[model samples]
Target: MIVLSEESQRTSGKDAQNMNITAGKAVAESVRTTLGPKGMDKMLVDSGGSVVVTNDGVTILKEMDIDHPAANMIVEVSETQEDEVGDGTTSAVVVAGELLDQAEELLDQDIHATTLAQGYRQAAEKAKEILEEDAIEVTEDDRETLVEIAQTAMTGKGAENSKDLLADLVVDAVLAVKDEDGIDTENVSVEKVVGSSIDQSELVEGVIVDKERVDENMPYAVEDANVALFDGAIEVKETEIDAEVNVTDPDQLQQFLDQEEEQLREMVDHLVDIGADVVFVGDGIDDMAQHYLAQEGILAVRRAKSDDLKRLARATGGRVVSNLEDIESDDLGFAGSVAQKDVGGDERIFVEDVEEAKSVTLILRGGTEHVVDEIERAIDDSLGVVRTTLLDGQVLPGGGAPEAELALQLRDFADSVGGREQLAVEAFADALEVIPRTLAENAGLDPIDSLVDLRSRHDGGEFGAGLDAYTGDVIDMEAEGVVEPLRVKTQAIESATEAAVMILRIDDVIAAGDLKGGGSDDDGDEPAGGPGGAGGMGGMGGMGGMGGAM
Candidate 1:
């Protein structure tokens, strides 16, 4: 048996639970103000003094460098929300913190951790049922509604002012890539360029290549283009292994050079023979080949990345050929036009108007790099929400509408499952109201008054009723065009409940003596026996168990 060191610290039972609950709550509080349309932005300054200013939940939490294990779990919840739906990250984190806060009260009332865990699991399942039952079905013909959904997700983001224009682009991009297999977001690429206003952002019917023509002498535009996608270089290949070619005679050396030149010419000839008016090569093109290609008036781009090549193939309806010898006219892809254009001091190739094109690009323009970056993030969230809505074929009202409805229903669910588990379920119902409450607080309204009014409206058979942060009134979110995909809300609920339960189940804390760091408490003090702190108690230090009863 290993001997216990005198410096080792242990805090078990109630002390451990309280510490974890406090840490989780503190983390929730940090992002609490950054909720809803009126939410405030956070400026994160790292040691290098590089600053990030945004209210995006995942971005803020990721930049915080959290040390407490319990708080980290809350961060993981936001990450999962972002990874799953790309929005509602703040809602998920806020809900999780509220769940822990509610659980702490139940724990103080002599409730067991296992009972709370079991009740939360049941409540989470019931939440899914309620959401599905209440979700509004959307079909392919509902373009206006889909645009509204996209606009809702983009509101309160950097691109909010351009929501109408950006929403159209997002919906069009999603619909273009939608297939029986589902929406392939990979098919939709967002390209950002600084110097233009946000309203100048537009969607390209085909892919935009950042690289320009390989040779200045090559044609800048090719109409009714037949494209060849070459996976290999258009140059003579070197021997796979080291070899010696002994040519003592000058004439023999000339013959060897002539053969190499001939091979390169044949490669270009093959592309021409296949009716390829434009060529996108995955590898380099020999200088002689470029010269020949330019002489033939064929446009060519060299050293295109693999992803670009695949996108080109999709946009042009062409197949990538590994060997030029196997190239055929039928193997070539077609585009209405391929042209090189100069933008922001850089040359960009535009492959547009392909028949039945499956890939597209959204070019985002802004006055500054920071504005463009935030615009991209905002558009990303909109794109993700639209994709999720199209894939699931269902959506719900936003602005805390679904959360309020779910809270009202879960309380009834709790009564039906009466027992020690009932309290946990009831606590979960109360926990969900945190969404509307926080929304109100962030909007500078009375949170308690907003929540009470929201519950009253929800109870009056108004399932879509939600707090209008701008007006500080409960209104129909659907009528206001505030909507989100069912998947986003469901994902937030599942991730938040699961994370809260996982943290609530902890009951013991044992820490190493030399640990000096732990998650910060409300006062910003490091908990005793934290990750790098000396042994002590309270805060996350009391919650961190050192290889014991995790």
Candidate 2:
């Protein structure tokens, strides 16, 4: 193994960590405005020239062509959020970014890097407690309210019917994937395939076929059929010599045709050997191939589209569609089957274990193709957000119950820790201010002393944290809760904390020249700013800064 000098190694590590912090914050900030009901919107065009306009965090992150490892890490946090909660990815990224930002500010004041890092960790712990302490009980009546909360997060981006549709779809997806473990809410699954337009969303007893019938004479239905969904073309190929043959005589041409017929018969035999009940071909079939299949009492449909094949595979849970192009081993996916039944008007239905089948087909309809396309996108975004929100353990009270409780707990926890660690812990407490600060800001309230007043009123045994002043009672939080998931409060705080720590660790900003001159030699320009520069690490472009230059 090659060994790096201690100084070189330290420099590399710091730069790597710094980049992660910087890129993460940039990605987080990009989606901040699209957070709540009052939040604005963003329209992004990806590198592929595809246009995406939405406030959804997952959509934003997914559409943004990001290459930085640090930025990708931030994306992963959103991914994890999507995977865990079915929503709140935007909030997580925003909070993480804000935490970094705040951390950077603390670092700039001659504070130790370690201290800021410790403070951030403590602050995060406190914030989590705050989230839990602030959680309000979710009641049956609030189910629609839960949906309203989800819709509020999704509105204005697209989906004119987001409130009604997202509520129903989100609930269905949640219930479908929800396990006995009290709703494994995070495992929201989505499958997308390009196919023909169908009617409004409905449960089909059998999978829908987007392929046109092979021929007018072919039977539209085959009862009690064992279906085989093939990814390969149901075509037979001419032998190289025969294909190139120049027929000088009619007799020679006849012989060549006979050989081709024999080859086609063999191909059909292969399908039979494999026990294919009803074969669905991915590409057009050759005349001879078709003739042989017909004679063999086999039902064959050709030119089946790829998307149709994928959807059918998922729906049937059968394996058969393997590579028809380039034939990579891993590209292979299974094709599922269902027993066939006659449906009038050129449509056919396949039912397999009627009682056991759980897959539902939502044949969404729209006035125009464009409307359908837009609606599909909206559904995808709603599904993504809902999935992320449900992934974690449970949502805390949205009306500020947990945050308030957490703030009190953190202060108590800090009081118990000893000496120097206590200072770091108290600083950590100060960091939690960013949460309520952000919530109030998004709620259209003054953020400055709002948190202070909230704490004051809550401590005084008042009915609620703050009075509306106009309402003369606790401010109504129903609308607030409905839009809470969309807020970037947690994200802002987290990002600031992260930024503060990253900047504080910067004792020096070394230039490329220093490293070439041999790591901190006596002749090296005195740490850029001198005296207060703090030795080798203190100089602008000094040993420490040089490490960062890369």
Candidate 3:
């Protein structure tokens, strides 16, 4: 059992919130270096001692079993990115972290937390603008680049030879779906089913065929056929009430048996008028219905499961099932003839109705089940990414590119908004500085020196003043308009700063008892038979500051 006191409640809440924010920022920063082309790698070890090395932000966050609420929120950011864009999860997180780091300075200078949050939002708006300015329209030549980009993104996402094969597949799929307006990703969809192999591979316009023959003598295909796959039994057979009872004495049972024969005959006559060329039954058919189907030239199949009936409905684009009593045009799907043949050590079924085919099955071959699974995953991710990109347009750089530029632009904008708010605005600019600083750190360079270099090289004037350790020469970044990938670095900066400021702003922690007491009319009251309340709820008396260092 657990008991909470007012003081303890107050202490724990603040400490926990702060711990979460601080630890989360650190985690975000750790992954920042892995952004962009020059990004570094992270080697992670799981509880089972399994090892993984990758710079992928989503993978990194998921693998690291962090226990901070604030940090988890950052993870949620990546999840959102993945769900919404199919990519750039790392970018969003990194930007949020950097924004948080920037906010921390303002917090230190006594700027309100709410004010810092507002400033960060403004800065984000500016950064988005920079991204828009950098956007370029994709063209014919750019398709290969885009393919390479898509392929690169898909690598290790699980396809073998994804570098070439996956890229080609995407291009082919896109071309197949393209119209005057461009690729129609929404209309071109794919579904996979697991079954024994078929012929090598082929495309058909209509859906594939899958229905068993009801009668052994029924023809495989009906030319220009309209098919109906039904759920109800077609047999005229009925189990009559006159069937003999199991009770002892054979004489009493013999009298009841005579009535059953009469009822079975009437059932047979009713089925003949339904006009069913073939009647598929979901269960065993009675002998009477079987005999009627044979005499009336009606094909009868029995023992189909309800699931198979539903599949048949979808396959033929038919309507729902009706009772055996009412069968009409509205309740039936089209009927067709299908041919099955052995090809390449597998059974292949072909259905050719009048006009063109609407569906095709692509037989993807793989050496092992795992390999196939991976390939399928890659295909799915690739398809999803393509669809998302087509819907949303191109992605911004993964490392802090446009965002760093945007930060600088916002700083200039802040200079004009003079007042106490300007101080907050400057603090906001300082918070934004973390993006570039983080980018520099991840690049294995000095943050202070990088900032100096960035400023000196800012043209509209002169250049060159930094020492290169290799050549002992001066280097300039501004003249080149050089900025690292904004996505990765900005994510780190925003996540870190947001986390840090959130930790610092926490002033109170309330416990169950505290809430209970606060809710009561009395100003104070001691709980009966409970453990003594400790003002230091987190058990860290005077150690509250440690929360910010997480």
How far residue 540's Cα lies from its native spot in candidate 2, in Å, is 26
What local distance difference test score does each model get? 0.84, 0.50, 0.47
State TM-scores per candidate: 0.92, 0.61, 0.54
RMSD of 3: 11.4
Off by over 4 Å in 2: 1-27, 45-50, 61-76, 83-86, 125-157, 177-211, 214-226, 237-252, 262-278, 282-284, 290-314, 317-355, 358-393, 399-408, 418-445, 448-550
lDDT of 1 by residue, 416-499 (tens): 997899998898999998889888988999999999899899899999999999999999988888889999999999999899
Kindly list the per-residue Cα lDDT of model 2 for residues 239-268, writing each as its tens digit: 567445588999999997887778767767
Better of 2 and 3 by TM-score: 2
Residues 24-66 of candidate 3: C-alpha lDDT, one tens digit per residue: 4555565666654345655666546666655667766776654
Cα distance off (Å), candidate 3, residue 229: 7.3
Model 3 lDDT-worst window of ten? 528-537
Which is the winner by lDDT between candidate 2 and candidate 3?
A: 2
